[model samples]
Target chain A: MSESFQRSAGRKVMSRSSAKELGAVSHLLVDAQQRQIAAVVIGRGKKAQLVEWAQLSGFGPDAVMVVDEGALQPPADDRERAAAEGRLELVGKRALSERGNELGKLDDVTFDADTGALEDLLIGDRRVHAGSLLGSGSYAAVLDESQEPSP
Target chain B: MRLLMTASQIRGLPVVTVQGGEDVAEVRDVIYSPEAGRLVGVTLNKRGFLAGRSREVLPAEAIHAVGQHAVMVLDESSLAAPEDAPDDVAHPAMERNVLGDDVLTEGGASLGKVADLVLLVGSSGEVVGYQIDKAGGGRGYIPLPAQLSVSGVALVVPNITEEFVQDDLVGLGAAVDEFRARLGLP
Candidate 1:
């Protein structure tokens, strides 16, 4: 089979299962060693949740097939755990440069989804090094307000 | 699986046939956008290491061709050297929190200054590491633990020791090798 077909088939098998019954799949946690799909984070209503990678019987193209959600131990807090897992996606984010020094955070990153390549990093509301003057400091600081914290 | 040309192919091209002007300088390096996997600009080593001293940023449109030996430029005169560049700083300085001031190492030594924080991704595109910079000097890649905390401008590392640095934790290659060895990947 073609590579794209194999990928689509895998996604289909995972999606066939009921996300609500087995637990909702927030994201697919990959096992880097095996270079395969590792686990699935399942949410329980608004309170409890569990990570069901080890207990997975199989995975489909869209969802992971698991035996029991009750068999898995739930994390400490639901929302917090979910957010923590979500943050895993931000690894390798490029830090922005300013005045030859790193000044602020790259708030967001846009990439080509199809090729999984990076496009640009949004460096918001941070100081940038423009140039230098005489004896004063040798660097000018400029701020970009677009990097402000989200409300 | 193999459709696009590799960076090495572009780099290996000769400089003679690609026409422009006299031998102003050789193509020193190519800056690629990792996100797009596209060549964005080229760094000309006109004056060798001094190239960094008076660098130039050529737009993608400036490229004329990627033949066997050379990367042809549209106009050689368009290549203007950069001025007023900052001194090279180390890599560790870049990891400071966005709101926090410059960070001093554990020994209170000023390790250059922070210029940026690099997020490391695995081959599968999962964020696996965080790299700190001391300006242009050196970069330290800190592997992401199961949990992370970022408050103000300070980022606290858990369970990371100086030994981690001794494990040949240098570039992306070294970092990935160390991580694989730690995970017992064969």
Candidate 2:
């Protein structure tokens, strides 16, 4: 089943070994080239922690389950650090066609809960296929111009 | 049909990079080369909620397309410092300003004065026509001739131009192709 990134935000992360809450989801780290979720960010800024997609044992409606506290780690690199800071958050960023026309702000992103593979990007009333996403940054998210969804 | 927009309307548009979709700057001024009948570059301003000028400029060669919402480039590296920008972009020539120049025919009959330039949308800064404040009243648009006899004071065009004066941009878009066809311009 597909899950929305917007809906997944704020869900608690629990450790299977300790059975204690580590933190809540702040946002998701996206791998633009692969069109998949790379990690789940917990908290923000200096307090931010990341749970890699590989570390998650289960992604449920109530909370995310990880092996233990060892699964929680600080941002691994500059890209992860930016994602932790919410600089690379996909939601709320303007969506632009490769030709430079504004489609709208990205409202939500649907991804396969089991695989972390992206499904669709919701822009206003339209649903653009994930394969159309070229890249994203601090300013806007670029999608293939020819992939514009019909109104 | 191709969409058309005036150069003045393009001011303040964000310069977005296609790779990361980052808006590096906003257009402060469109640098037009009157002799070449082409847009050479644009002076930029910092892009954000707060307004401020940027030191970088984007040359036309680096532009992928000029759309209604944004000016697209391949990436941030396409932007250059003022010193690296073309001479016309770095130091715009005052005499090259086409706005307010009289529009005259080969027969010396006055049509109007240039008010703004009409550009083809989705093109890499292609100027298609001129928006003029007609000699009699209101505004009109005229398709740009293949060759211009431009002077600081006046722009002399073919006498046939008088027949192609469009009342608005929508009409101008159609007129451009017809006019070009009539003049045998590709």
lDDT of 1 by residue, B96-148 (tens): 22322233344444333323323221011122343445433575544433333
Instruction: List candidate 1 segments past 4 Å from native.
Output: A1-20, A31-38, A44-48, A76-85, A90-151, B1-186
Q: In candidate 1, residue B11 scores what lDDT?
A: 42
Native contacts retained by model 2, as a fraction?
0.71
Candidate 2 CAPRI level:
medium
DockQ of each: 0.01, 0.57
Q: Write the per-residue lDDT of candidate 2 for residues B59-137, one digit (tens) a residue.
A: 8999888877889898889999879888888888889889999999999999999999888887888888899999998
lDDT of each: 0.35, 0.87
The i-RMS of candidate 2 is: 2.3
Give a tens-digit lDDT track for model 2, residues A1-151. Answer: 7799999999999999999999999999888878988899999999999989999988888999988899899988887888888999999999988776788999999999989999999999889899999888888898887854332
Give candidate 2 regions above 4 Å deviation: A75-82, A147-151
Report the Cα lDDT for candidate 2: 0.87
